[model samples]
Target: MSFTEPMGRQRADDYRSAMVSSDPLMDVAAGLDAEVAQYFLVSARCGCFMQAARSLNVRPTQLRKHLALLEEQLQRTLFRFQGSALTLSRDGQLFHAQLIAMAHERKLPVIEQPLIRLAVAQSILHDILGRDLVALLRRNASVRLEIISLDSDLSLQAVSADVVVWLASTESPLPGPSFAVSEPERLAPLEYLPHIAKRYSRVTARPVSLDDLADFLLVQWQHERPVESFRPWHDIVDQRLAGVVQLHSYELMLEMIRCSACIGLLPGYMGRFDRGLIALPGLFDQSMQRQVWMAVKRESAGCEQTRMIVDLIRNTFHERREWFDT
Candidate 1:
């Protein structure tokens, strides 16, 4: 393909002028093969003909022939061999710089957006992080963020995510260096409080005490796999209570509490988002609180995008600390 085909005639003339007059070899800029120039650029960037060939989806021999044609056209040696390593020659470096500048001037695609994958606990994602993540996407177009809702018992090491947000009890906190995770940051405390829908409260007498919950249907969120350290409703309600319903999804549990005459435990912060939910008074205590931790994989901790996301989450939690307070 000819690089000038998509560019306006004046822009193509400007591109040629930018490359010409600077170097004797660039004098032939008017006759440069765009495809051959691209092949040379990729080969220079990869520093290996085979790697560049794979990136361009072309055979190694074909990539070599294309670069050879570019060198013949420009009358300059574009690459040199040092031991087993392939490197751009002095002439090649100059051409590479000019090509980069031309691509920028023409507004051509040069780099791919960095992708950062975030794995979050189901409840935290729905109740808190989802909005912040959406705002981040709108604010930054250079980065690609993937939000994965974790609904099962998958460990941090098992999931292929750059960042992880999960609920951790005091007894079984986030794993250490062995899990290939950086030092975890405690984002916020989740104070679980009993809540009943406003409509449900009007239909039935508000629970005055924890024991009063036994009279109403209880909707509880149960993990797909048993987590011994996390028991949100440990002594608050009996699982053997007659009308108790267990569910694996936090969303379903919230919906059940809102639509039926069922009472369930939710984080204190949830009351701010769902005004329809009324927290039962005098039922919450310090024992019901759990910690929310955020950590990045050790390998991804240095990424700027990952750090940016970490800061956004940290700031959101800090700003909403009051909502999580009992």
Candidate 2:
């Protein structure tokens, strides 16, 4: 219709109808929600509402609502329902492809991630969690990691870590100023330290007794070695009186133990994984083993970053269960 046409009711109605159908900005004005798109994709991947909800750590009802709202906005049914089964419709597949393409093309808006403050000793960080932690940081661009290097005697509350990983024994357990603690994940034992000599053919046989261990210097990770704190195997150390050699990190201690005839307290996981190290038959009592504890402040227990880190830690432990039993 030309603008020079006479003003009439039929002409106005036609103009309004054309504007509504042809407007390029209508879809843009409706607002594309990334979260809704994520929900749809997760549900499709999981192939069920319940499983998708569990995967995304959200309520199934919430996911349903997101899918319903997304369908309403797009004016299309995205899922085909057959009794209890759920499958993506043709339109849903197309939408999924579009959303994934947008993300791959870097067209999606970036979401901010919460900063995570983690406190752990340098030794534990180096020997066990170093690789996993590095991978988490590299994979997650949103997260800002503020790692607090803690000393053995440093108080947990003093550092105020959102999450803290500490080495604790069954006898000592986790200290006061309570945080939600994960199940004790046992470290690989230092029993294998004495066997390093045998593995390297430096010794004819494994050390048979505590007296035999006295022939070698007792090396300990500087961050975890007990000074004033009570060690579980009090008699093992007190009776033998092996001179202690403290190293700054487990890697250095392992290197020292491997190179020389030194007996160090090495993590069981580390010992088991390295073919060059072996566990002495009668040196260590399993009851005296130490464990790795992941603790989080009660206040930040629900924080996304804290939860993600905790899950990653648990998953890492699960993957290395042969070495780091939970």
Q: Which candidate number would show the highest lDDT if scored against the true structure?
A: 1
Give the clash total for candidate 1: 0
lDDT value, residue 210 of candidate 2: 67
Q: Candidate 2 residues 1-326, lDDT tens each?
A: 12123547764564445335533223522346767767877788767787777656577788899888778877878788767777766556545545554577666665566788888755567756778988765544336789876656545546677877776554554562244545444433322224354454445655777667666666666555453333533445455554766667666777877887666655555555567776565564543455466667777888977988778777876777677553
Candidate 1: residue 225 lDDT (0-100): 30
User: How do the predictions measure up, each by TM-score?
Assistant: 0.63, 0.55
lDDT on C-alpha atoms for all candidate structures:
0.73, 0.62
Model 2, position 263: C-alpha lDDT score: 67
Query: TM-score of model 1 relative to the true fold?
Result: 0.63
Per-residue lDDT over 1-326 for candidate 1, one digit per residue giving the tens place of the 0 to 100 score: 12223556675565566566666655554346677767877788778787777666577899898788778877888789888888766567657657777677777765675799888888888888889887766544446778888765555446778888887665455542235777777887776677888987774689886667778898777762344433546544455547888887788899999998788877777779899998875764445666788888889998987899899888888878888765
| Candidate 1 overall lDDT versus native | 0.73
Q: Between which residue pairs do clashes occur in model 1?
A: none
